[model samples]
Target: MVNDKLLQNLSRNLLKILDDDEYYDITIEVGNDPYVNIFRAHKVILYYRSPYLRRILSTNKKKDDKALIHHIKLPNILPEIFQIILSGTLL
Candidate 1:
């Protein structure tokens, strides 16, 4: 089960990223099923299961564009992921 503290942190980070212009249209999903949490942006679809054990997956995108695929295993790592995504390093 996911920790409550972790979930709070993740939600905070996601909100911060949502304020950015570049990611304004980006979609954020959190769930158990990998298929359900997957998000599609333009021609790319970013998917993952969780933070630590999760494997980031993407399709129909170039290597450079794949940087947007940001998959966090836990809510605690949301801050880091948020920074990366905002910097355009991870999606």
Candidate 2:
């Protein structure tokens, strides 16, 4: 059986690792125009969290190339909305 406290702690640790440029493997660029907000996260975490993201990230050639940073563009989403996504992850 999974321990609730243990699971929550693990999830918290993963969230703490978000936007950590040193260990991050994915770069999410939200919005467009003069103001674009960039977020750094882990592809593995994202893959396990969302199927649509899994499909989209899978199709991106840059990730397959094993570059230093994988890129994803979300031109339609606002930074505020994306912030909710980032904060809501694993919560």
Candidate 3:
């Protein structure tokens, strides 16, 4: 079960962090299941299942280098994760 208030707060904080950076373009949407929030920017996308869990996927291609997909575990750390991703420091 996802907490509505917690979702709202997470979204708000994420937006603030994104707004502070000019290099990041952010798009946030609620998934069809109503239990996930999808955040997309550039070649990166993060699916936030709840305050305690989140999945991050990113792609980066450089010439002959193959594109890569990265996954991170965010456990009860929404704010920190949001800030890190928004800051473009998560890889």
Candidate 4:
């Protein structure tokens, strides 16, 4: 149906934003030590998509004054697992 196609297109577009480096307002660092991976994302998208992240963001609402970018570090999750988690959140 038309609606399904529209949704598919929307999802594709949303995924494109994940790789956009110019406009992202937040940096998420996943994992610890030598295995860490950093990802950039929009705060508004993260705010609405996941309740767990919402709670985390709520506590860390203050962005760095110089760059205006918020930073979050997750030492628990592996980078590979976090990528999968983030993709699910965007969908």
Candidate 5:
């Protein structure tokens, strides 16, 4: 019982980082056309959470001398659906 609360607190604190946009290394653009929603996240945290994200980011990785922003655009997901997806990924 105590362990569960501790884990929940830890999870909430980590998820708060996403909300605060603290030390985010990557940006995700969900949807296209008329409108799009952008979300900032930590690359390392995302890589460990989802294999699909890990694979995509790996393939998209660029080799360059200068600093470049890591931007991922997903045209498939709608704004509302992406919110749900993001919620699930947090936990």
Candidate 6:
């Protein structure tokens, strides 16, 4: 029971990090043009939690001039679906 409570607290903290904007290192562009939604996410959390994102992030190199932020475009994924995925990931 204690372990479960600790995990729940950890999940809550991670979700807070997910909602944070200032420390984000990745910019995810979801959906097609004109209707795309941008999401700011932390690379460390994504890299450690999801293998699919890990592969996508591995190939994406950070530019020297840019603010050291990694940008990824996902035209096939709907914004709502991506939001659901993000929400489900932490829980």
Model 6 earns a TM-score of 0.73
TM-score of each: 0.26, 0.73, 0.27, 0.73, 0.68, 0.73
lDDT (tens digit, per residue) of candidate 1 on 4-45: 999999988765654544653244453344423333232121
Local accuracy of candidate 3 as per-residue lDDT tens digits, 38-70: 444433323343322232332322366453432
lDDT of 4 at 67: 66
Per-residue lDDT tens digits for candidate 2, residues 31-89, read: 99887988888888777777777898777755347577778898898877777767663
Error of 6 at 67 (Å): 5.0
lDDT value for model 4: 0.82
Q: Between 2 and 5, whose TM-score is larger?
A: 2
Runs off by more than 4 Å, candidate 6: 1-6, 61-67, 89-91
- Which pairs in model 4 have colliding backbones? none
- The total number of steric clashes, by the backbone 3 Å criterion, in model 5 comes to 0
Candidate lDDT (C-alpha), each: 0.43, 0.78, 0.44, 0.82, 0.74, 0.80
As for TM-score, the candidate ahead, 1 or 5, is 5
lDDT of 4 by residue, 1-91 (tens): 5698899999899889877899899999988999888988888877777887889988876555576787899899788877766676431
After superposition on all C-alphas, the RMSD of every candidate to the true structure, in Å, is 13.4, 3.4, 13.8, 3.9, 3.8, 3.7
Q: What TM-score number comes out for model 3?
A: 0.27
Model 3 RMSD in Å is: 13.8
What is the total number of backbone clashes in candidate 6? 0
Better of 1 and 3 by lDDT: 3
Clash counts per candidate, in order, are 6, 0, 1, 0, 0, 0
